[model samples]
Target: MTVTDVIDRVSFMDFEPATASFRDDVLAGLSHPIRRIPCKYLYDAAGAALFERICELPEYYPTRTELAMLQRLGPEIAALAGPEAQVVEFGTGDGRKSRLLLNALDRPASYVSIDISRDQLIREAAALALDMPQIEVMAVCGDYTQQTLSLPTVGRRRVGFFPGSTIGNLTPVAATAFLARCANMLPGGAMLVGVDIPKDIAVLEAAYNDSAGVTAAFSLNLLARINRELGGTFDLSGFRHYAYFNEDQSKIEIFLISQREQRAAVAGRFFHFRAGERIHIEDSYKLAPATFQNMARAAGFEPTQVWVDPDGLFSLHWLLAPL
Candidate 1:
């Protein structure tokens, strides 16, 4: 079976670097007094599919709110991106936001989708290239956070598209560093980023603890992954997905709780979890516009435009960098 056939002029590259970081990170995190797992591992195939479902959940406001804002600001986003621009997207899952910008962008010369999941990148990039034949499609499957990205020759003006508030996954310092890296990558470029604004605690809590439990499944999938890949013998049923809004931190925290005291082995080592103990999995930090703007400025990006949704639940920021 052809994994990424060039059906309609789209090019695909699968790059899995030689790195034992996954296992190393897993072992180190589990060895910690408070267990933790990097949020990136939560996107293994099953986890990615679960996330797609989560985006559709009624309680999840970021996806829909960001989509609405993108739809309304298509013209403005396109104009800000300017003409003959190239779009580089981070974590190109489903390519929903990319479609919005690509469709609106005028005479954009190329589209580069960078994602860690080869399956996702190939699928979405091929479809996008097929749908928009005028633009060059370069689908890259690799880690974007590690500062190891090297882009191919493409359009002159690069416009970065980072949607879905994925930046929320990083700490404030990391986010600033990430934005700085992006700005440095595209010297004379601009970017449109989705930032989830802090809102009512009740609303935030409901969003993570959806009635349908998709988010819960998404969180627990991390354990399932450990079991499948790391020789882990976790009793999936022994744990429950837990999420809450940390009022002080202004972030949504996800954890996996051991219902009762239990022991699980990973990579030939057994780890103990106390009854009702929690393993921190992820944090989704909601940022105020000013805070996000400050990050962009420090990253060498000047915020040119900010679009807010009707209810003030989300924002789309347009940041331009120097030549």
Candidate 2:
């Protein structure tokens, strides 16, 4: 499971055309009356860099809160994950949070970090492997949702760690299905997950639409990615970033509003947008601890523990598959 092997695996998948087609589909969708795209694609190299900046923003509470919960509770989480367990992380961005557990675990036999961004996953996993040569590094370069994670069949225990309020991106139905998938993968074991607590509009809005505009830039970079990857002609200036709470949906909706009526073309498709029409980019669904636990229960996992931050902004949950 060398870093070079990870590159080869993804290279064999032929991503360029797939990404280009996805970009075209998104741009075409944006022109429709009900404009939207799955915002996960926004994490190309540049988008990843911009998101890192957004994480550091004072108003962005998810990253900081998750880090804090892990820092304080990681030892307890690690103790539950047996010494020889293989740590498989979904959406292992930069593998920073994973390292916190690695430091506390007696010694994980192997680490598998799955992410959609192939380059970032490989780079970070390789660095961790270099630092801790004893642990085997398996980098799966595919969309975490779609990829079939091949865990080390040899391990005594297979524990999955999905930290970050990332599960919030899914709807209740999707979140339940995803948790079920994790339970099916791990069987009778634990899965560590981070969830953001539902908060007031003031705090949630500030987190998404930060004053420094880093989040705004991160939202718009998807357009830049489309332009570069799909041979799209989108005037970046034609769109303005938007993030606000959709009170009815109970989620923060991120969008790129057309600043002016404009026409754009991508991948042989043309789109027309009216000024102020929002092309919804993403949704961050905040969870009440009870609501999240209920969802987990539906997915065949029982929430054994919840670690809340001092500010009550976020929580880390340890769920066990049905015995």
Candidate 3:
């Protein structure tokens, strides 16, 4: 083995899209009075880049707030993970929080990065492996919610790392089912998850609808993705971004409102939208520690500990799967 022989330990088990999931979804969603799409689809290369910008916006508190909490608590969380635990992350690969947690772990057996996007997953995992040659890197490019993760046989204890309040994106029933699914993944293991704490409606609203219109652009790109991949003919100018907090549901709602009554064709099917109709893009709920604890318990896990910042706008929890 030469001095340049690095990254040999990195392995990528990728899932390539073979069918038209986007077109089928677009067809299903647009055939409704108020169209809806899953938030998971909003991570094309352009969408992902826009979201990175969304995190840096002044009004976006969750990203920075969670990062700060991780800064102070990563080591303690790692200690609870015990030695040589496998760290598994869901969705896209995050660099900032990844560094903090990876640096804190004590000789973690391997790091498994999973996501729906093959490019982003492979790219980020390869980069991390090249940068930190000591740790084994296994990149699985597939929907973390659906795929049963295949990790190295050497590791016994697994620690699931899911941050950025991604869990907030699911509905109550879906969240419970997803958590139960996660609990199933790591039998007798541990998970570190981030949850956005409930706060004033005003603060939550501003985070999704920023002054700089970055969020707007991010919202519109979803339409562009449909146009590109599904042969859609959506007029970008005819739609505008809308975001608000739903007090009754305690969640953030993001939509693309039709600026004018327009008809658009996607995958050979045309749909008409009224002048003021809205296309639902996302629904994200803020979870109180107690709320999350209840949800975790339903999912077959015991909530072991919770960490919060001074403001209590966000929380990081450590959960243990049934042994």
Candidate 4:
């Protein structure tokens, strides 16, 4: 059936009010000297849907590459994770990877899906619970980056699942801190993280700047979200999506550039934008395998094993927490 049909099977915990953080972050980010928005706010329902479409685009290799790798290596990953483990996935978008992972794990104790998008989180979690009735499902709605999440206590080990190379959205320092927090949260357990590898500049840029314009739509949806949620007066036509690989930073930087001078109001506050002025939207950093391992080690995790696809487009890192 549908997600609503199986909603009762999923346990949901909402830690953040839907709009407060969005409003506050929008105001604060727009007020900055260098106009920017926290990339986390980009996952409203519409944006999430656009992202799913982007995953299917031929230019977007990360999702397909990672999924293939997971399908091929699921058993090996399950072996490292061990049996009866509680799988806690961060930013559990659509729970596609989680389903594959939980299927591979031997009698996984439970599945905890955390995400900022509440509606999508509940929908996916409910569906997952229905599909895998043997495992318990708990859906947490919150910005995992900002909140100290209270997870369920289970006798078995807690395995953290962070797929989709979303870690690249955070700065290196922030990623390290985030991993350290995961280490604390899943003590004596382990983490399975998907990381995107640095590739040709043209390939990197094409992934975000797709020919079908889906990625552009995904970027612009942020403004639409603000207009709908925060009463923002943003003229969607006044801006254009721009993304490029910054070789120095080793990341793909995405921005919305104002086509002409204009002003947009959000939450009763107005902000001015000059022609060609850019509002930084996202950064997807590509770290080398050795570099990421070092960062994980610095974050109090023992880098156990890393599996890379033959194409060298993506990698899955398995890290162990100290006993």
Give each model a TM-score: 0.96, 0.93, 0.95, 0.97
Q: Compared with the true structure, what per-residue lDDT tens digits does model 1 show for residues 237-322?
A: 99999999888888999999999999999888999999999999999999999989999999999987888898999988999888
Q: Higher-TM-score candidate among 1 and 3?
A: 1
Better of 2 and 3 by lDDT: 3
For model 3, the run of ten residues with the poorest summed lDDT: 1-10
Find the candidate with the highest TM-score and give its number: 4
Ranking by lDDT: 4, 1, 3, 2
Clashes (N, CA, C under 3 Å) per candidate = 0, 0, 0, 0
Evaluate candidate 1 by giving its C-alpha RMSD to the native, one decimal: 1.5
Ranking by TM-score: 4, 1, 3, 2
> What do the candidate models score in CA lDDT, each in turn?
0.87, 0.79, 0.83, 0.90
Name the lDDT value of residue 126 in candidate 4.
81
For each of the candidates, the C-alpha root-mean-square deviation to the true structure, in angstroms, is 1.5, 2.7, 2.7, 1.5
Residue-level lDDT tens digits of model 3 in 1-323: 22123235567675744438777777888887678987878888788788889999999998899888888886788779888878888865456687688888888777888777655666677778877777788877676656766456546688888899899998989889988888888888999999998898888999998999999999999999989888889999999999988888899999999999899999888898989899999988988999999999999999989988899799998999976
Q: Model 1 off-target regions past 4 Å?
A: 4-8, 17-19
Using lDDT, give the best candidate's number.
Answer: 4
Q: Candidate 4: which pairs clash?
A: none
- Preferred candidate (TM-score higher): 1 or 4: 4
